[model samples]
Target chain A: MKITVSEKNGKEINVWFPTWLILNRFGARITWQVLKKHEVHITSRQLRRLVRAMKKCKKTHPGWRLVEVSEHDGGRVVIDI
Target chain B: METIGKRISRLRREAGYTQDTLADVLGITPQAISKWECDITCPDISLLPALAKALGVTTDELLSGKSESEPAVKIVPKDERRDIGDMMLKIVVDSNDGDKVRVNIPMALVQVALEMGMELPQVSNKDCLRGIDLGEIVNLVKAGAVGNLVEVESSDGDVVRIFVE
Candidate 1:
């Protein structure tokens, strides 16, 4: 599944396969160990700051819909990234 | 019990004796000398005199734990007034889909953007368009998603203004 960010200026930033960007932004090393658990990919431009900001904002407001993403396991997810 | 690790380490160097050399003079293993400095073990009472002589210090100085002192840390007054310039920019992007995204760039991030060749405005909270579009705007907002911006007007004389280019 993919997550899309709609900007205030009538534009959309589409984010596909957010796992890589998520883990990378959270400073989780994208190794074979993580890949075996879940799959993720992203665009050429890295989303390090984007994911970090999302996580930081989420800490204050748990319901801010800045970037929406899909989860695989449907388990209890704490969105640190 | 009062052996100072740093003091021992410093005295060892001043003596110009390698661990093995000191150990040889003291009739002990080099590993034992290492442990003494590392504080893993202490020297025997009888060995204090020889150790002090070799280390160029009196037994009182070594065992008493007095050595080179450190500078006292000066705590700055918490109330020192810092005037962050009053410049603030509020970018509220409302997409055709009805999602309104607002980003309040902090002074630090604004300075960072300026350093990266982005144009920033002078005066407090003046809005400057650096050719930032919707997609880029979203990305920038997403990058700064963690911070909440409080719009401060330029009237407040003591303030820091961040220019976004």
Candidate 2:
């Protein structure tokens, strides 16, 4: 995963991390529980499927821009997965 | 529930789906489908949306044998949440005086510090981090909470954000 944070002052920070940080069993299971809090149902098996799908996408789609957002105060954030 | 099973079975056949086809669409085993049709088990509430769509029915009909406008996918089983060690917590503070503070510490260290009642110099000494309970943050993270865990704004216009990625 890659993250970029831009402050209102125009300072930009970039951070890149391995996908395994979130795709690992512990991270995936925790994510399943978190989504449950939002009433989004997902089984452990289903979450595993999601992880697998993400891994496949990672291989097939390099440098995929997953999200981008800019705040009213001029701060911007972007994510690539 | 038996009627629901019959409804699913009937609708599945009506939609030209063998058990295997429907199972494939929803990413489940055919035996689970058979069990559902036999009332031996119920589909996870989370699966209802995809299941209903596969069978050309609304979730309402799937659950109660009555048709409604559309399907709603909601509710899933609650289960255990566990995490691994050596994860890092990132904290970013934008001070009003234009100073930016970025700190990263391993979650394993936070857990140990909390257990030992030891204060961490990395964050404890920062003014923006004062008065916030690191222990509670750890507990929330342990409970499967992630993303931006904390955001604080001081009267002087400093902003602090903590993220667990």
Candidate 3:
């Protein structure tokens, strides 16, 4: 799998993954790994909770969209849309 | 014409103040704020000044539905910077494996998939061939820049792409 991130400044960052990552349903695992590698510490459990809260937010507030999920200083997950 | 309650609710949300937050600033209960938003009761005239100030609006704007001053830029706290950015995720699964597939799973649903025991790769620094700070992405989008951010495809023809514009 190939992942490319394009910034507003026209700079692009790309990450290529092996075919097995997606074939094995390891999307979430890879996401956590990427975040951890970037020094954004968040546990698997916390990531699940954050995702659940984001889903709930989207369900209740259709006007709000899921933007980005980040870890705060106090282990708080910040979901911005 | 929009009712006063609706106006209050709209302004409050635009200011990024929840009912409880706005209530705390105005020394009122969240229930009171809810009632005002629900149009069950109006705020006391004496409370208009405090309410307006808390919401960063003039009493005239609150009462007459007009702003005499320029629109204020929303000031997001530095610690809360993570909460900014626009992202769209598009997924397409096309396989003959006789299993159910889905497309257009929002970011939230992707999390749901993970929670449901979908095994993903264990990414390490070596696996991450490239990386971008999410905050930079948010800033670029805020500055009115727009473009595709990321795209991924699986061996089985599943495609996932995330973009901001």
Candidate 4:
């Protein structure tokens, strides 16, 4: 997934998150939650990795601003898509 | 239009046959016959010939008016059934409060998630998820952005929350 961080000064910064979903924290657990709500299924390991990522990462940061987010065409993560 | 129910009951009475006797001849339960007469559904097309013969009528008579000489054909048309698996869909919604809208997920997407090694609850029914980040679900619900923060409880005790800004 790609996240665009825009500061109050009208400057935008982009960040690329992991895509394995099963291996990446934001990718796997968040995706699984979305899927499961829709009755979609995912592997246990993928879900575990995502949950781990979410727990380990902090939601707020000093340098980056969150302006927009998008998923890549495939599994890879890209910014400014 | 004459329904299957009215036709069956009229035919049975005209033939001087009890529902039980006709049901036995048709190899169906009496209740099944009753359902047919109540307009629940009609008998299968395969039974058309047998039913006509049993009622001392021709297939044409059963399908159309009493005589084939009528100008406008008044035959009954069968209801069309749809194959849900073949359905195609795209959905989008804009919400200011980020209220979680429950949407039905497709089986194909579920299979993809399983292949990716995501863990799921034991129950095999559709559910709703809550989160501000919906990279995967974007393809499913393409609303611009959700701003309402809410918590959704899983069938299990776990709670999924979405914080919309």
Candidate 5:
């Protein structure tokens, strides 16, 4: 997953995350856990704000899609696109 | 606004500890405790966790004067689409008074798994679902109709809801 951060005029800021990561459950959960482990606390309220921002940007920016594979029982991997 | 000193004083008193006793527990001088209670000096930031633990409250409660017992509704942003691949998904909505309603995905998402060549469990709750077409549900979801599937409220003011958005 790629996150882009840019600062404008030392005040305005912009943040973006991979749309596929936001749309996928396994990807989003893994990202949340990794951020928490690194002491970067992103609460649900903050996540909602991020999602709303992403939705607004999706209308303008070209979106990217990804296929995620999750491990299941019996040594199986389920692929979701 | 209550000063940190007043909050410390109130919590210390509520915990039934004299200034000297509290200082003894924290390994600080009684004068320092007196200063903290009088708003003359504040506890170091490093001591907040220990201070909160000593006062039998969370660090948030110690700082914000709001106990966790208060009803603070939190909006959780959830992505429910991944439950589709799991096949054995069950959604439950419940109230504080032990009222609940459950919805089980018997075959809707399971059909997606089937199409993807994943093995389905032999014994499943497939019979529980009413006459619903899995293909139609999948088509609707692909067409972006995957939100707020069902919602119902009981006469006892308990709400049970399921959403796949």
Candidate 6:
């Protein structure tokens, strides 16, 4: 994911994050535990599907400028996935 | 126009069924299957449903050589879709006092937080943000929806918009 915020004065803040999702089998265990802690009882099979969905979502698509909005004052915000 | 024989042949081949296999599934003879594929004859109306089922297609598809108008599966191109986990939930607030607030959180975290009953008082102590349910938004996302999930303009001129991208 990448984010850019630009002000009228030309100062820009750019932030980029890569490989934030590590939803492998190991992560599935931890995820199940975490969700269980919150009293959400999901089966391991569902967790595995979640891991696969996350992997498919990230691996198939990259660097999409999903959101870009400009304010009346010329400040702009853009988010990419 | 394509004939029913050609349709049956094409669907049969696409389904990996040889004439003998298709005949076996339909309780018919391979000669009948061969004749149909060769456009020598059409299946009897009584066997149209059975033949369609054997070929893993609708009777309309069998007769018309075209898929149903509403297909069971539609191929969506990769670029035309964003999977749920890859999406981000964005919350934007503009206060009447001229403070602009923008917060972006990944949809995965929002799911976890929704399960945890999390709150975002910092964004707005008002009832608008507090009253909104994240699970409903997530459900909308699962239904193949994007864009502004919630947009509220208060009487006081405070604006709040929550969207998924």
| Clash totals in order | 17, 0, 7, 11, 0, 0
**Residue B8, candidate 6: alpha-carbon lDDT:** 78
Off by over 4 Å in 3: A1-81, B70-165
What are the lDDT figures for the candidates, one per model?
A: 0.46, 0.70, 0.54, 0.47, 0.52, 0.72
TM-score of each: 0.27, 0.34, 0.29, 0.28, 0.30, 0.38
lDDT of 6 by residue, B25-71 (tens): 88899998889878888789999988778777888777766666654
Model 3, A1-81: lDDT tens digits are 344444545565656655344433255577678776756666777665654555454554454422221122212121223
lDDT of 5 at B116: 34
- Flag clash pairs in model 6: none
Docking category for candidate 6?
incorrect
lDDT of 1: 0.46
The reply for model 2, stretches above 4 Å from the true place, is: A1-81, B1-82, B119-124
User: Which sequence of candidate numbers ranks them by TM-score, best first?
Assistant: 6, 2, 5, 3, 4, 1
- Measured against the true two-chain complex, the DockQ scores of the candidates, in the order shown, are 0.04, 0.03, 0.04, 0.03, 0.02, 0.04
Candidate 5 wrongly placed segments (more than 4 Å): A1-81, B72-165
TM-score of chain A of 6: 0.51
Candidate 4 wrongly placed segments (more than 4 Å): A1-81, B69-165
Give model 2's share of reference contacts: 0.00
Sort candidate 4 into its docking category: incorrect
TM-score of 5: 0.30
Query: What are the per-residue Cα lDDT tens digits for candidate 5 across A6-34?
Result: 23233322344455666455555675687
Candidate 1 vs candidate 3: the TM-score winner is 3
Task: Tell me which of candidates 1 and 5 scores higher on DockQ.
Answer: 1
* Of candidates 6 and 2, the better by DockQ: 6
How well does chain B match by TM-score in each candidate?
0.38, 0.46, 0.42, 0.39, 0.43, 0.48
Total clashing pairs in model 1: 17
Q: Best-fitting candidate, measured by lDDT?
A: 6
lDDT of 1 by residue, A1-81 (tens): 245544445466555554445445344344323432433333213234434433444454333332222222221111222
Per-residue lDDT over B31-100 for candidate 2, one digit per residue giving the tens place of the 0 to 100 score: 9999988888989999999998888777887788755642222222235333424345767767776665
